[model samples]
Target: MNIKSILAKPFAKTVVAKIYRQSNNAVKVQQNLMQKLLSQAAHTAFGKDHNFSEIKSYEDFKKEVPICDYEALKPYVERVVNGEKDVLWKGQPLYFAKTSGTTSGIKYIPLTKESMPTHISGAKNALLHYIDETQNADFLGGKMIFLQGSPELGDTNGIKTGRLSGISAHYVPKYLMKNRLPSWETNCIEDWETKVEAVIDETIHENMTLIGGIPSWVQMYFERIVERTGKKVGEVFPNFNLFVYGGVNYEPYRNKFEDLIGRKVDAIELYPASEGFISYQDSQDENGMLLLVNNGIFYEFIPSEEFFDENPTRISIANVEVGVNYVIILNTNAGLWGYNIGDTVEFVSLNPPRIVVTGRIKHFISAFGEHVIGKEVERAINSQTENTSISINEFTVAPQITPVAGLPYHEWFIEFENEPEDLMVFAQKIDESLQQQNTYYFDLISGKVLQPLKITVIEKGGFNNYMKSVGKLGGQNKVPRLSNDRKIADELSKFQQK
Candidate 1:
């Protein structure tokens, strides 16, 4: 380990702003500060600019601001895309982070220069803190392969844009700029398709030592590298000091990653957005991720029950409990005030509140007259399908509305590793498992309120092509296990003819 990396831990990545800690004493102090800031932002965002008051209480702030999901504020997003400065943010948005919502069409999220520092600084702090916790400062010196979205930048007319990840081209640690994946002049596709080859080649030949990215896409790259090099992940890149992944839960993909690598790869969780990186896994080997302080925001959590199947919770941060899943409500320097990021999370503890991202609220489905949340579906699938050697690569469940029959049943499109003969039996097991967690689904199924659940086994790369055809990137963002409905099932089945 180098001396500079040792000294850099606490000092190098200093947090740029002060955030409210989750303590009553601190809450009291922050409540006063939050009101003043929120009031001030209102004036600034709405043209009064200077006459603003400090936030006095969480309740008061909540009453003043309405909940905002991306759908509710599409006009504001359009303003940012059209470069409308005053309506969206004080400054013109430099880029739009294209985030896909289940019901609310594709979101062209806004990001400004002033607002941009939150994610950048937070990510840096996360890396520094990871090094500090793992006591592996030397890990910082290795090449990092960000298994991110395709690199193709913007459409010629600027109407279409790349993944939120493509923005990493503009901001990364200036020092590690050379070691990072994307080049200054190259587009995102080149970064992924073209530059990725160099990263793979270097990992094999130059002793590359670090890997970071979303697990699925990262796994894809690993598969490609393995296919090309004829060497396993660990043997080809033995010096890999760490692997960082985020954007989605690592539970389902973790063991597969280990199996391929032939070793336990050190990993850190990254919670990033086109707008910002809110929290990073601070402590090494810890189960939870800490909220980065001074990361330019006041955050809130609307209780899970408040939004289990409602309009959505835009609750206050102070009112949040220790072990509840709540949708993230954020007030940040990025000109976003009382904004709902749409991500659902649960607190592991309240003392400085360590949170685990539960899932997205938008990704829930209610097909068989029973609302099945993403996590519930995931839990059922993980448990019921554990014994099967055939792996489900991508899948979605939709309501099969038969005009002849009034009942609408769940139709599943599953991409499997190996085709199983008893597909109906597999569906029954999963149905049974789902029934255990959600009584409503079981009741509906048993009463024949919905038709018998149908499963259509898809070709291996069916969903992958479907997403590519839709212009969605092929990582965590695509085909989340459970979705609102299976609109893409037809597109998924297109691979059978291929």
Candidate 2:
């Protein structure tokens, strides 16, 4: 073993052990974190406004602070944007993670000095956990690539601002600098296609051992490598054994990914957002990621089914139950209190608070009173494709309420890498799986209120073309897995197979 690998083993073990111990007392750790956050921010504008000084317990907190999406919190965020110190948190934010929002044109999420370390440490510990379990620190000895946004920062009201991934680029540990690939110059290229080409040119022949990115973007990179060298990714980088990914479910893309790599490789899932790094996979044998309870954030959950109801039941980690989908809320050291980041999750293990991200609160199809979430559709597609030759490049679902003919149905736009022999049979299988998982959907189909879901073949590069048309071609942007309306489906119609 090389020097880095040798050193990494001990460090990895230490971190993993620390995480295990902290997770064992998850509720207490979160309660303590909540107190710390309230006490530290008590004098701030938001804290004072919410009577943070009088809030002695979680119940008091819930009664004092109302849940806030970006619009609800915009007034305070505006003050922070105009360079107000102690407006939200204790002092001026270190950086603003600029992200595109649906209703709000551009969102500026603060990254305070206290909360920034959690983002870096969360990713670091995920790998360390893998190393501790598998004794596979050998990857640390070879080149690593994280396909991310440009590290370029732009000023927003005198605060350094960039995409969350770009901000994270500035914090890559010194130890990994030697092994990190795609030279700094290549990473700074703004155009994703250009950046990918440059990244290929820079690291195509290097001893790359790990690759990380959103599944769709990484698929493009893998295809580029194969096109350029007429070799599978595994052949190009024999040591590349780990793929770290986030932002979307990886199961639907697994068959295509393994096909491109030419073998099965280990992967780590991360639940991160501009707001905070909430969880990371801690074990290869586990079903979900370990929640960061002791991190500088306190969490709340509103049952997903009741999320739209008036006065939803919001509970702490201590009250969460396994298998129940809940919309996650955050109160972070960054000064975001009772913040709704929109992601929904389900606890797989409540003892140590391991969670699987189910879907986004807004990213679902309930057009026919049958709520089909991202997780359900992803599960349905994967259920059909597993152990089969069928592999898809990418897909999205939308409600076809008023079709040219026949009853209303869910339309699935799919870009197939390897199409199944019988398209109708494949669609039937996926539809059946989806129905089984969602009782409402099953009832609707049985009642003749909706027809079976239809699959529309999207020609190669269709999704990318659609993303490009909207100026979100790459870097941290992903197509929502499902939509209630036909906005995306209408745009994708031109690319559909004849």
Candidate 3:
């Protein structure tokens, strides 16, 4: 066995056993974690302001700290940026994860020493779990690539700042250094199109065994590889067997991905954000990611339906129920208090606290009082297209309030690899599936308030073109599956078929 795999086997055994123990006692562990976080930060600036010392329970916490998005927390973040110590966390943040925000412009999320290791360990444990289950560690000996942001960091105030993926680039385990590619020079290229070309140049002949990234960007890389070699990815790298992805759902792109690789491969999903590494897929046989309950963050949930209410019903992780959609909130060791990162989730298995990301709280179609989420659209399309030759490249949904004729409808803009034989039939099937899942949508259609959803075909390369036009072409940028407004739909109209 290779050195990495040999060391991994025993380590995986020990860690997996510990994980089982922790998960079996999830409620107790989470409660303990919450207390620990409160104790640790009880002396910080934010702690004093919020009266964290007197808060002895989750109820007290909810009353003490108001739930906040980046904007709400911006005042404290501004203090941190001005070189204030012990403001958010205990000391100066180790790094600021710089991300573009729509309304707020540039946002800088804190990453402290206390919370950084979880990001690395979360990813590591996922791979170890896969190895433990499948006894397949052969990929360790071959090159692995994670198509990420430019590793070249910029300075903000006195702290290093970059994309979360870029910040993570500096923390790759020493053991995998020899097997990781492309080189630092290629990784530091600022422009994405240039970087992809450099990556292709550097690793075209390497035995690439594993590929990781957001599926859309990785698909671009894979397409370039195929174009260069005139062969499927599997033909070029026969041992490439694992695809690890996050940031967006992979179901819509699965058929196209498998087609590009010329075969099916094992895949792992991760739930990560600039705020923290929340969860990772723990088993190849499982459908959902195992929530990292014992990690450095304490989680809270609010029912998605009540999210915009004046006083939403906030509950601790202990009270979360299966099959209910929730907007996840974070109170982390990094000093974020009652932070809402905006993603929604649904618990599928509460035994070990496994969850499927349902959608974003703000990213949905609620026009006409039909609260249609990303998961519904994804499920609708996947159910109809599965086992058929109709493969979607990308798609998004938006409400069409004022059609030239007839009632308003939900418009699906799809970029297809292979169009269905009957477009009307395909649209009907998806609309039927959606109606069955969402009662509000069903009522709208049944009551003649809205017409059945319509499909608008986007020309090939249209989505990519739109992304490029927005200057968010690659690396963690993904099109929201559905939106309440026509902002994206109006932009995509430029590429729609006549």
Top candidate on lDDT is 2
TM match of model 1 to true structure:
0.82
lDDT of 1 by residue, 309-407 (tens): 555556555566776778887766556666788788877766565688877776666755587776666666676555555455666766666635567
Prediction RMSDs, each to the true structure: 4.4, 0.8, 0.9
Q: Kindly provide the TM-score of model 3 when superposed on the true structure, using C-alpha atoms.
A: 0.99
lDDT of 2 by residue, 1-498 (tens): 799889888999998888888999988998998999999999999999999999999999999999989989999999999999998998899999999899998999999999999999999999999999999989988999999998889998889999999999999999789889888888999898998999999899899999999999999999999999999999999999999999998899999999999999999998889999999999999899999998888999999999889999999988989999999999998989899999999999987889999999999999989989989999999998898889999999999999999999999999999999999999999999999999999999999999999999999999999999999998999999999999999999889977
10 residues in a row with least lDDT, candidate 1: 15-24
> Candidate 3's residue-wise lDDT over 172-255, tens digit each?
999899999989999988778888999999888999999999999999999999999999999999999999999898898999
User: How close is every model to the real structure, measured as TM-score?
Assistant: 0.82, 0.99, 0.99
Preferred candidate (TM-score higher): 1 or 3:
3
Pairwise TM-score winner, candidates 1 and 2: 2
Candidate 3 Cα errors over 4 Å, as ranges? none
Worst 10 residues of 2 by lDDT: 175-184
Candidate order (lDDT):
2, 3, 1
User: lDDT of all the models against the reference?
Assistant: 0.64, 0.93, 0.92
